[model samples]
Target chain A: MKAAKIVFGLLAVTFLMAPLVTILPLAFTSSDLLSYPIRSFSLRWFEELMISDAWRMSIVNSLVIGAGATLLATVLGTLVSLGLRRSFAFSGILKSALLLPMVVPAVILGVGMQITFIQLGLVNTHVGVIIAHTVVALPFVIVSVSGSLAGIDMRVERAAMSLGANPLRVFGHVTLPLMLPGVLSGAVLAFATSLDEVVLTLFVAGPNQRTLARQMFSSIRENISPAIAAAAFVIIVGTVVVAGLVLLFRAAAQRQKPSTVTV
Target chain B: MTASMATSRASGRGSTTGRDGSMAASSARVAAMNGASAPFIALEQVEMMFGTHRVVDQLDLTITRGEFVSLLGPSGSGKTTILMLLAGFLQPTAGSICLGGKRIDHLPPHRRDMGVVFQNYALFPHMSVADNVAFPLRMRRVGREEIEQRVTRALDMVQLQHLRDRRPAMLSGGQQQRIALARALVFEPSVVLMDEPLGALDKQLREQMQLDIRDLHRRLGLTIVFVTHDQGEALTMSDRIAVFNRGRIEQIGSPTEIYDRPASRFVAEFIGETNLMAGKVTTTGPDGSLIRLDSGEDMAASAADWPAAGNEALLSVRPENVTVQPVGTARRTERVNIMQAKVADSVYQGDHLRLHLDCGQRRMIARLDRQVADYAVGTQVDVVFQADNCRVIPT
Candidate 1:
């Protein structure tokens, strides 16, 4: 069994990592084109991307939207999760609605939101784009945090309450800390989703609010450049780092967690 | 919408003659009116409903100051619901509850000054043992020095002071339960409620924890309302037990009173191992009675509340109280309540022998003191119990 497990693990590693190796090295090609096995590597593309207005603006916009989406989704999702968890009212319908964005087609969601944003006079605004990204991102946050909350025994909350902390104090002191890893994992996913968002950005983002994915889309459509490859390299590295941190936090949280903690 | 239980208090009216319960009645009345000697924690007509099915029918219970009370029952008997109501988690559907002479039924759980230890220890995982123990103090904003002193003392009480710096995840199940207990008691609330606190521990560990909890209650003189489905636990830990059944109080009395003289058929069957024989009252006398069993033979079973002649009743005899002997014994004076039977099966249980006897149409169980000295299966024997040991309850 142990030997079989090792073999399975090796197979998974090869399957997951081989594609990354192929895609990543193309970023450093000395040519002004995308190719592997470069004759020489240079920071020329990266420097050129730094000077480009569109590239710079997209990077800044990604940061703004990513941070905004993370904060909004984490707060709203965490609070909603706590509410749904503590009470039986409307839970089934609420959970389904919150999870809908995760399964629905992004194109469909973008179209629906575009119409809504136009009616609300929010289309072509940064706030509109952030809201659209958050609509797609909130589910991930809710699932992550709520999954953690599910694993937590509400008994801990009662224990706090028994010790004389009221509802708000119990949430702030006992609950939020115990489930922090879960909340952070959700926030990471939300930020990462917004950072790579493209379809929603195209439908609703203002000229100033264009995301990295939107900028990359236009570049590839008009003229694919090594600068785009350099941006991709940066994004790939950043994503791996954030995703890795999330996996680590989740693993750490799960390792010490009790199986019967009332999930 | 919230409903609270307002159990009618035993009003301090009407004096009665006492067995040396003389002028004490008048003093007791004055005390009741003055709100003195009232239970530190009292559940008054507490009811809980799950949809329209009343899970906790009107329950009236009182825990005197510094007394230990246990709510004992099988699952779905609403023992845990009663504990939750006391903890302020479930709103009692009918009556008001009083804690130390103050109405606290409407108070939120946190403001009720009661500590609860859950079946699964609800220790905060991110915090160390000291932090978890100090949580109540921190919530109440006690001084840091005082918090330190109290946490250390509480940990010491549980003999876990050395492990105080460790997180709860590092503790064993028994240790975690102890920490839970210590955390609950450290706050020095007027009352502490435990909801099946030892349910998660192994048998040996559970036994030790029971003694530990009992000792703590004694040492601290704290009022406690412990809820458990384990009848043995209730017997071991409680000064008095409230046995629950189908959302109603089956019986409430001291442990031995509940065991030796149960008030109802449910209480008799629930508290211990017993052999029940449904019968009709054939004769009644001043000292004892004889009842005809369902198999049409008269057996001498006795209870104070034995019904009049021809009334259908059930007889409950404890297994250990039944004695087996060779048939046709000639002592003559010790032959009361004798039944001729054959031991159809026997199992040696090290300390006691458990015998299954086939007597006419009824099979009876008898627990004998000797394991090895027992009749072989299918051997003819006389199963006898004293008239006092055979208790009769109304069907």
Candidate 2:
């Protein structure tokens, strides 16, 4: 039975990792044909990605849009989480509405946003793409932040207040610091979500505002190049690094949790 | 707020002068001084309603400066609600609260200048012990040097100065509680409100902390409003206890007054173990009143609030007040009531024996000293109590 379980686990891992295994090595292939068996490995494709104007511009755009969307989403989502903590009549409905983007089809959101952006005269601009990405990234931020908020004891905030800290000072000194790990993880998730978003960028962005994910998508359709593989490699490594930092933050948070006494 | 500070400081000085005397005498002096002045904290007709449910209904309470008052009750009895109201965490639906004769009902919790220690300690996890104690001073924008000096002194007061660099998670429950106490007091606020602050400790630790808190209250001349469901804790630590039942105070008085002469049936049952006999007042006299029990026994009891003859009454007698003697060993004397009883059961406690006696159909408990001769099951005995030891409460 144990052997069968081990076999099944290995099969699952292989199935999940097969696509990355097949595609990543192509990024290091010397030939541009994208064949599996490479005669030699070269850094030419990586250098081309950095030197090409279209690819370089797309990389910069992705970073700019990702940072902007993460900042906007993290702030708004944390506020929404705090406000929703003390629930009112319509709070549940509002929360579900905010989370709608996570389940709604990305194509539908893209088509809807394209028309709205044009009406707002935000089309073909970096702001429009960032705003579009933020809408999709908000659910991840809210869910992460709300989880952290729930672990906190409300009495800690009250203790700060009783110790002569006003509302704003209590937030700054107590509540914000306690929930920092959650906020950091949520920001990472928001950035990763913005980095990979393609359909919304395709609908809302023009050629000048093309993001990395959009460029990769168009490259696959127009031409199969190793440089696209290099870009994918960079994104995958970047995501792993961000995820590692989040894990570190969570571990530190767990270690420092205050002892809760029960009577 | 400033006026309240002045009054508290004056009481602090007065207490310091009497520090060399006995604790009881010093506290009495403080109480006398406080009684001669206006109340430090006063709640006048305060009502707190939660939607359709009224948590605190038209309640009034007053705490004299330097007095430690405990709001004692069962859960849902509005004792904690009153504490929160006093701390400015919950606004009253009606009426007002005054500190040193200044109305403070509209002030926010921080502006009220009150320190509160929560049941769970509620220490900040991210802060060191010294920083936690220094939080109030930092919030007041005290200079860094003064903050350090005060934090050191506060930690010293709790005898936790060695643990100043450690986080709250690393401390034991008792140590964490001391940190919470130090943090609450470092600001030297006019009043300190504690909500079952030692409820999380074990029995021995809780008892020790109770003594420590009482000592602190006497030494610092602090006006404290404590809330606890534990009656023993209130009796041990409080100068005055307000026994609450269903959003109203059943009675409020000194611990001895509450225990020896409970104002109502609820207060009698809530405070400790007591034998309550349903009776009717048969005759009233200058010395005491005669009560005819429903079980066809007659007893004499002194009444704090005299009930007229032919009024319904309850006789409350603490078990320790009831003494058991071998049958016919002693004759009844004036102002003493005696009954022939059969010992149904006797449980040997550490320092005493709890005897359960049967007087006709009514059961009575007597706590006899361990040195007293044992009365086995079914042994005939006489149960005796003085009129002054039992109270006749009008029901």
DockQ of each: 0.41, 0.46
Clashes of each: 8, 0
What TM-score does each of the candidates earn? Answer: 0.88, 0.94
Docking class of predicted structure 2? acceptable
Please give the CA lDDT of all the candidate structures. Answer: 0.81, 0.88
Residue A182's C-alpha lDDT in candidate 1? Answer: 92
Model 1 TM: 0.88
C-alpha-based local distance difference test score of model 1: 0.81
lDDT for residue A59 in candidate 2, whole number 0-100: 96
Regions of model 1 farther than 4 Å from truth: A1-23, A35-37, A86-90, A255-263, B1-37, B282-286, B330-335, B371-373
By DockQ thresholds, what CAPRI class is model 1?
acceptable
In model 2, what lDDT does residue B369 have? 95
Which residue pairs clash within candidate 1?
B4-B95, B5-B94, B5-B95, B5-B96, B6-B95, B6-B96, B7-B44, B7-B45
- The residue-level lDDT of candidate 2 at B296 comes to 79
* lDDT tens digits by residue: candidate 1, A1-263: 99999999999999999877776776777887776558898888888778889998889888988898889998998888887886577788988998899889999998999899999999998889889988999999899998898888878888899899999999899888878999999999999999888988889987888888899888998987778778888898889899998999888886654333110
Task: Report RMSD (Å) for each prediction in the order shown.
Answer: 7.5, 4.2
Find the number of clashing residue pairs for candidate 2.
Answer: 0
